[model samples]
Every structure is written in structure tokens, then in C-alpha cells.
Target chain A: MEEHTGKKNYEVDWNEYLPGVAIDCVIFGYHEKVLKTLILEYKETDFFALPGGFVLKDENLDEAASRVLFERTRLQEISLNQFYTFGSLSRFNPEPMRIVMQKNGLEPTKSHFLLQRFMSTGYYALVDFKEAEPIADFLSDSCQWYDIHDLPSLLWDHEQIIQKALESLRENIDHRAVGLNLLDDEFTMRELRNLYETILGKELNRSGFHRKMVNSGRLNRIGKKNTGKAHRSPYLYRFNT
Target chain B: MEEHTGKKNYEVDWNEYLPGVAIDCVIFGYHEKVLKTLILEYKETDFFALPGGFVLKDENLDEAASRVLFERTRLQEISLNQFYTFGSLSRFNPEPMRIVMQKNGLEPTKSHFLLQRFMSTGYYALVDFKEAEPIADFLSDSCQWYDIHDLPSLLWDHEQIIQKALESLRENIDHRAVGLNLLDDEFTMRELRNLYETILGKELNRSGFHRKMVNSGRLNRIGKKNTGKAHRSPYLYRFNT
Candidate 1:
């Protein structure tokens, strides 16, 4: 706690961020046939939270979500959608925030902006699982990926945020190529189906799933037909950009 | 102006409402196979806008949207979805707001709350067009449904708001049963398909659309099969509640 509080990076500049509003991200990645999300464990406490940050006065909301995700995961190319804004009187408990401030070596004042109730706008993105290297913020000790079904104790309505994000992601699958970002640039149809199965939390039929994806006109088969399966290797496909 | 500003309803009690946040709704309705949305005409100006309102300090975002919609349409049973949040410096211009205040017989001071920047939460709802009676707010002369394709001059970023709402509505159909609300308690399959076509803004293959809807397991056949197609009436469906 002493080490964390003494760090200069922990200080917040209230004037730079939008007052009474913030952005939180629910970053999804597919791995081991399970849907997972990034979570952060707060320093010097057992509290855990989703990656979140404040929007600057001059910046737009989407840009703020991207910035927050990048700050935590160092991944900038991930596409994000502003799904929903979560503002409820029940989420206004200040205990977790108070602990965060004290751990950062700052004594809370009654007028501190950090203690004010925030109407956080929720944004979400799907990233290639192997690509993101989670980096915790000053207030957090570690950032790591955890299965959506098995999460640690979440802080301040984060469980609800993740639930909303999953629902939005399910709705966004067609218009937004969310599954594409969850896999590498070149992946086999089998791998793609696995990703979808993980995301939707159910198994899909083989030929039906393949036909639906092919008919959607969103997939492009890679490698030449004449190449002949390259020693039994499955045909690779990439989402049409 | 004197007639409007002198009214007590126009006076805002700032302490009771949340600052820096508001809700704007795009209420969708179907008529004559065309998608229509509710629009408001500013009291004394030719400018038009979507029906919108402020959120009370204790009210949740969804509650605020419902309250605002009920206030204008007098329809409380309408179901709503929080699709997106619109926040950008480009949308914060104060001229239109100044005109709105002034038309309501109030002068805009340099530091008036209405003149400040606000990040609006966008919500969309589908309502039975014939059932809803549009009632304008104090600052608006009339609230009426207009064809989405042939909207009047919209104020602020309302045009973009409507576009976003349409896309969200399309995405929301599978999970939300949004088209159900645009119809009465009971409807025939052809009428449902027409609503779907209007909402999607495209013509779908007849058999394929019908098959897909039936297979989705969301629709239930109304009236017994023993009741033959009386006078060539098609089998009706009401979404399974």
C-alpha cells in the first residue's frame, strides 16, 4: 500500500476529464472454447473491476473507450461499439472508490470528483486472445483474463456490465464482425465455428453453421483450390474486410 | 414568447434532475408499409426534433426514457431499449438550445444550465402507431409521426440519432421481439412480414422469411387450426410472450 500510494502516476487530473461521466469496457476474447473477459484486481484490496477511464473534454465517447482499453491491454486496433450507458442509484456506493483513493496515497475530501457518482457509458470489443497483454492501472495490482462464467468478486456493478456486454455482443454478431477479431488473421472454418460456439454458449450444427457463414458473403477462403489441402490441413478463411 | 415562458411547466427545477445527462428517444411506428418515427415541431420555429426530456436525479436511465415517452405520447406500456449513448464535442453547439429557451419566453444567461454541454443517452422504442396520441411538450407546438425517409429539418444531431436507432432496431429484432410492439395484440403472418419489411427497409423472399420466422420459435399461432381459413384469412400469429 505504501509503495502504491507514493507513485506519482496515481494522481488524477480532474480538470482533464468529463465531470459526472466515464467509460467502461468489457473486452471479450475466445479461448479454450470458453468466453472470457478482462478483469482487474485492485491494489491492496480484494476488489476487482472492468477496465474503465474518464472521457476528456475534447474527446468523443468512442475515443475514450479505445483509450481506456489501450491503457489496460496496449491493443489499439480493436474495434469498439458504444453499447449502453449504466447509471443507477444502486451503483453509487463509495466504499471501493474510497479504498482506491487511500491506496493511491490520496486522502479523500468531501468534494473529491472521484467520489462523485458517475454515469458510466459501457463500450465493448472482441480482441484476439493471444494478442492482448493486460497491464493494470495504478489503482490495480493485476489485470488478467477470466472466464465470463467464472468471475471473481466484481466491483460496482461490473457483473451487470459484463452481462450487458455479452447480450450486446450476441446482437452485434452479424452487423459487426465481432468473431473475426477473436481469431487470428488466418483461421480454419472449424476454429471460427468454435469461437462462435464459445460466444453463443451453445454447440452449432456442422454443415448448417458452415453454410450459413458461407452464404452470409462475409468470409473469404484462403489458399488456392489447386493447393489440395496441404497435407490434410483444413482450408483457412478470413473475414472479408 | 410571453405566453410560453410565463407558464410554470416551462420552469426547470435543476436540483431535482441529473446534470450533464439527458435522454432522447426515437419512437418507431409502422403505417402503410413505411417506417415512421415521432418528431416534434419547436413551438415557434420551423426547426424539428425528436421527443426528448431530462432525467431526474434518482431515476435510472431507462426509467427516464419511459417517463419522457409517456409524457409526450401518453403511452406507458411501450417497451424501450437503450441502444447507444451519443457524446461528442461536435454535438454540443448551443444555438438551437438558446432558441428553444427563448421561444419558451426565457432568456439564456451566460451560465444557464440548458446552455451547457450534455451527453445524451439514446433509446429506441416501437409503439402501435394508431394507439399512440402524440402530445408535444411546453416548448414544442406539436408532436407527430413522420416517414423516416422523409423527415423534416432535424435539430442538433437528431438525424444521426434516428439512423442509429434504426440500425439498433434491426439488430434488436431477433432477441427483443421489437416488431411485436408495432402491431396490436394479434396479427396475421402477412401483416407481421410487412412490418418486418418496413423496419428492415428491404423486401425479403416470401417463403424464406415465413419459414425463418416460424423456425425461430418466437411466434405462436393464434386461433385453433380447426378454425379453417375463414374467408381466405391467413393464419394469424402473436409473439409468444
Candidate 2:
């Protein structure tokens, strides 16, 4: 069992944080044409969860989210977006929290702040994975990347958080300038297509992809001219460089 | 002063609402080819604000938002989108709230929940102006629709919330099936264009708009075949049926 624990292991200053609220971040990175999400393994427990923390009473919610994101990923530069908030009564199970506390050599108090019902604001960001130095939160043993498609069982509704974050990312992929964080400036057309495929979970026809990208005017073309009719598939994909 | 006041209004059981969190809705409507937003003018005060309410300890956050929306607009079935959560330190001022409480016959308790800091989730929805019978919240004198472009000075950061909501709605105008809420099924092309133009805050070329609408495959031709080339305005608008 890992001896590591946040300040809460001793005593939590309840007034330091806003009650009934927390923040969770779904940190995503793209590399080698595969999309990966950063997750944490809880200390001395089989439980895994998205990196999250509480909002300080004096801090803006967005600032609190950014602090949590920066603390784990160590990437200050980002365009973090708040996608959704989750607050279901079922998410308030105290059993897992008890296990976490006991395993970490801390006694569980019925009135413990961590054991209380909390609604979490879900924030997400796209970052250059290579630049991020992953550091585990005090409650977690380790932080690492897992393919979005393959992940261990997660705690609470974290799986749903990841799905929602991914959905939001895909929805705004065209306007979010995601490539600035995920790709090199001198990347080729094939590399860009692979990035789209990874995010979209489907293969796009090569000719059609080229036509759409060129027509979008977000990408500057060098060398030879390219042209083609997009395939008949009804899905229209747009990109922002 | 109007005599109407909300239930806690008189006695806000802090237990009823999850403290420090609330929900605000920027209800939108399109009629007479003009876009308007629902706003409330507080009773016994010159204060105006969006329709909002606190969440119960047992209720889902979205459910609370929907309840508030229903209480104000009385629209039960809708596609309400949570656009953003506002929680800046500047929004914590208790002066306006004190005025509201005093004017509403509420004793200004130092620890009053309404005087404390609150983070509000902003929600937005489109509706037929005729269908939504505007009812003022307990604290307000009248619930009325004001053209978004020409609105009275608003309270708190609600102006920002409305701007953000309208922006989000416009961003998704093409993708969201907004026609269902704002327009009749058998609407004419000119009417549909007017609706889009109203939300977009700009005029669209008639022939170009028709060609693009038809090409997007969201609309079916009524009788004689209509044809035209979309002007090269560089905007690629899509629509959902």
C-alpha cells in the first residue's frame, strides 16, 4: 500500500473548498495517430479515475480546473474547455472512498468532506503528450496514458466523463485548432488524415479528405495541386489548422 | 411592489438547495423574424436577471435546470443545452442581492444563502414565442421578451451568460434541429431563411441560401425545381431536419 496521501489524510480544512462541488479533467493527447487519455490509479487500491480535485472557496471554478489539470499534466499551456457537469445521487457511494481512506492509513469519518455528495464539473484539454510530465495526485499512485479505446475499469462515472469529453472534442474538432497542440507544423496530409480518423473512429476516403481539407482554406498548400470529389457519405467533417 | 414572491423566498430551507450552486436559463425565441430572450424584472426593485433557481439535494443538476425553465416558460419538452458555468470572483458581490432581499421583505441575514457566492450553470433553448407563456419568477414583477440586441441593463454577469448562450446557439444553429422548436413543419424557404438570418444577425443571399440549403439535403423541394449557385461567402452552413 502506498503511504502517499494528500493534506486531507491528517485533517481537511472544509472551508478551504466549496462544499458539494468538485472538478475532473479528461486530459487527451494524440501521438503516432492514436488518441490516448490520461488516467490515475488510486493509491493502494485497484481503483482508477480521471484526474480531479476540489475547487477552493476563493478560486474561480475554471481556475480550479486549470490548477488540477496543470498539477497532474504539468502543461500550463492549454485551451481547457468545460464540457459538462455530473451530479447523480448514485455517484455518492461511500464504500470505495472508505476503502481508499483505510488503505492509505487514514480512518474514515462519516462526516468526512470527501465522503460527501459532490457534483463535478468536467473539464478537458488537448495537449502535446510528449511535453507533459505526468505526476500523480496525492490520492493516486501513478498517472499514465491509456488508449481511449482500451482502459481499465474506472471509479464512479469517470468512464462516462471520458466519453463526454471525447464527444465534445470531436464536435468542435473543426473549430478548436486542435492540430496546433497535436501535430507538427510541417506535417504531411497523411498524418493529418490519420489524426482525424483517430478522433472520428472511422476511415475517410483519401481523395475526398484531400478535397475537403483544401477547400476549407485553413491549411496552406505547398508543392503540387490536389483536387477530388468527396465520397457520398453523409457525414461532413471540417478542420481548423 | 408586486406581491408575488417565491417560496424560499420567504423561508429558503438551506437544506432544500445544494448550497453554492444554482442554474440560470437564457430562454430564446424567434418570432416575427426577430430573435428575443426572456428576462425578468425584480419586484420592488429596478433589478433584472435571467430565470434561475437552486438545485435540491436529491435532484439531478439538469433536472433542476429543466424545472426552473418549466417554472418560468412552462415548456416541458425541449432540448436544453448547458452552455457554460459562471464562477468569477467578481460575481460574488452581495450588494445587489441585499437590495433584492430587502425589497422582497427578506431580512438580510449575514449568512443568508442568496448573499453568498454561487456558481451558475448557464442553459439555453429555442422555443416558439407563442408557445411559451412567460411567467415571472417569485422575485420578479414581470417576465417579458426583449430583442436580444436591445435589452435593458442586466444584473450580475447575466449579460455575459446570455451572450455566451446565444453564441453557442448560433454555433450549433446549423447542426441542431432548431426548426422543430422555432418554425412550423411546412414553412416556406423565405421564412426559413429569415429565421437563420435572425439568429445569425446578418442577411443571407436568397439564391445562394436556397442552393446551399438544397445541397445540404436537409430540405425537400415543394413543387417546381429551384436552382442557384451559392455565393462564395466562405461560410459552409449545414442544417439538420
Candidate 3:
């Protein structure tokens, strides 16, 4: 009975402990035989980060995620999926920020204290670069897409968040094709092949890739793309959606 | 320049104004034609609840979740997918737990005050009931599975958590299956069918379901069930895992 009472006492004490919660975005776009991720450089703070925003009083989680994506990307109809909620209490520090905080003579107390104790919800999206006009909202100086394999030192554990999102995307690739969002309305078969090869990190047989794409019945074959050379033109395809 | 400083001040204040983070579990199991979930009856407390625990200081969020699951059900080796995070300040009681506090004759101080200002990460898993031998658990009553569609009244926004988990499960069904944990190594196709029907809330055509199951190539057909009925015994199957 005493043991049970002690457990209850602990719960009672922890019940009132208030901690901060924030949301981060991991937006991926595929281009140039490389899987790329959109990251932001904070203008005033000089912090390179993912596009993120706080939850509002009247917003649902899905709404909050959508608002963050739409507002930052300036994309009207892109869909953002809530992939993971990172509450490890350690995901807040994206490595480089430690140096920035120290160099700025800002005792890590102000940033570290709240961050190490807080939880962050991670949302990711795939968007067509042609549609997604990157807007430098909030603290951002600019938003740019970097090759996933070669990312600049990011602030906090944002790189880890990107890696996790890519892993999830790879596992669910057969269920839904995400690279459709990274292309224009019409794209060449070569471009599509490059996107898959980049994400899967293996060179797929060209014929086999085309066969699977055609059989998947999710793409509409369009007119050919002329290379303006004597070479055979590659057919263009658009997502059926 | 003054406005920029004011904006910086707002950003600083924003960190201080965020809500606290918490974790919620959507523990699902299969029973009858109704998909069931494990919930707890809180003793000396007004409502029944899902077994939940706070993320510990020294542990990762996943570790904390597994600890909570093991402590409640005594079931280990379960992998939980962290999918959604709910962050509605109104999710907590808009008013204080005034009646409950009054009943317990406790004063509501700021330190002790409870409002629904939580950002809860949702972790969901499937656990075999035979393995889930609840031990040293906090529940006042035996942990049992209640039909998810017809769940008992629960505290906070637990109902929403379960609803969202089920929706995620349905959306991702083609990529993953959940209820194999609840069944034995060998199960009749009928048993599998029943599980799917319950989750999907729709009766599948028997032959079509069987055909698709076989086509998926993820199941191995074993011998027949030794039922003493005149009708042909249904074939047993095991997961290819």
C-alpha cells in the first residue's frame, strides 16, 4: 500500500510540470539525380533551420502543419504528412546551434534550458518546386533545397529529423509515389528515373523502371520532350492526380 | 528597426508561451468482430483512462513509451509507431478539475493548477494478450480490451487519439498489417477475415478476400483445421515473417 501511495505521490507531483512544445518541418523535394531537402537560414539569428511554426489557440494539429507548410512554401495545394512526433527532449539541439549560442555570448541557458525539456512534432511534405515558391517567413533569410546526402551543418537535430523522414518515405514508396510533387506538370522519363535512383540510392534498370511505372497506372503519358539534338526524344509523363 | 526588435521580443516571449508536451498510447488488440483497446480504470479518480506515462528525464521518448507499455501490460518487444501529436490547449479541461479537487479537499494553486495545455505524442502498438500479463500496474482493475468502436467514456482527449490511430492504420493498411500479434502462429483465413472486417468496418467478399490474401504472397498455407464438422475444413495459414 505504501508503494502504491508513493507512486501516486510521484504522479501528483509531475502532473503540474509545464514544458514547451514546438513543431518542425522536414520538406523534401527531388531534383537532379539527388533527393533534396528544403531548409531555412534564419535572417536575424543566422540559424539554419527547417520551416517551423507554433500551434495556434484555435487550430487543430493538421491545420497547424498545413499552415506552416503553405505559409512558408507559398504553395496553395501541397499536402503535408505528419510523419513523426519527436519528443526525445534531445532533438532540439541541431549541433551547430551550440557554437552559435556560445559565440554570440548568449549563455546556452536561454535556448538550452527550454529546448532540452520540450517536445517537438515533426511534419514533412513533398512539393513540386515549380509550384512551391519559397517565402522567407518568420526568422528565415532564405529557404533553399540541399542534396540529402550533402547537407550543410544544420542547426539542432534537424538533420536527424530529415533522415528519419527520408527513411519513412522510402519504406512507404510503393504505397504512394512522393516524387510526383517534385516535378512540373509534365516531365521526361529520364527525370523520373533520376528521382527514383536518387531516393533509392541505386541505379535501377531503365527498362524495368519504365515497365513498373507504366504498369502502376498512376501516370498519364504525354507528348515527347525534344532534346533539340539528333537523339531519340523521351516521352513526357504527368501524375494522374 | 524598433519594430524588428519588437518582433524579436515577441519571438522570445513565444518560447515562454508554448504548451507542455505529453505522450498518449493507443493500445489496440483484436477480439470478436469488434477491434478492442486496453484502457485503465483510475482509482479514486472520476474516469477510466488509457495507461500513460510522462517521458522521463534520462530516457528517450520511445524508451519512455515502451516502459509505460511494459509497466501496464507486462508485455515487452512491442514496437510502437509514433504517428500523430495532439496540441489543443482546450484538450485539457477548460475549467479546473474543480469538482475532483473539491471532492478530494485540495486547494488549486498555480503550481498545482491543471489546465488542458498539453501537446501529446501518440504512440500505438499491437500486443498479444497472452503475453500481456499485467504486473505492478497502476490500474485499480484488471486491464481488459474494450471494443474500440464502442469504447467506454475516457478522460481528456483519449477518444480522439484512438480515432486518429485507427485512421492512420487504415490509410497505411496496404503497407503494413497490425493484428497478427493478437493471433496465434497459425490462424484460419476466417479469423484473419474477421479481424480485417472489424478494422475496416465492412464485410469483404469471402472469395475475393481469400484470393487477395493468396496473391499478396505474404502468407503460407498450412493444413486444414481439425473441426469435427461435415463441411470442408478451412485451410490454416501462417505469416511469412
Chain A agreement with the truth for model 3, given as TM-score:
0.74
How are the candidates ranked when ordered by TM-score, highest leading? 1, 2, 3
Interface RMSD of 3: 3.7
Off by over 4 Å in 1: A1-11, A174-179, A223-231, B1-7, B174-179, B214-237
Model 1 chain A: lowest-lDDT 10 consecutive positions = A1-10
TM per model?
A: 0.88, 0.88, 0.73
Candidates' lDDT values, in order? 0.82, 0.81, 0.67
- Looking at model 1, residue A45 earns an lDDT score of 88
Q: Write the per-residue lDDT of candidate 2 for residues B1-241, one digit (tens) a residue.
A: 1122245455556677788898999999988788999999989888989988888878888888888888888888777888888888888888988998788888889988888789889889888889999998667899999999999999999999999998898888876457777887556678788999998889999999888877878865444322343342223333344
Q: Model 1 lDDT vs. the true structure? A: 0.82
The digit string of per-residue lDDT tens for model 3 on B117-227 reads: 667788888777556765323323445677886778987788888889888777655544474676788899999888788778799999999999899997899888888
* Candidate maximizing DockQ: 1
Q: Would you list the clashing residue pairs of candidate 2?
A: none
What is chain B's TM-score across the candidates, in the order shown?
A: 0.90, 0.88, 0.80
lDDT of candidate 2 over A211-230, digit per residue (tens): 98888888765433223533
Q: What DockQ values do the models have?
A: 0.64, 0.57, 0.36
Per-residue lDDT of candidate 1, residues A214-234 (tens digit): 999988998733445567767
RMSD of 2: 6.9
Chain A TM-scores, per candidate, are 0.89, 0.87, 0.74
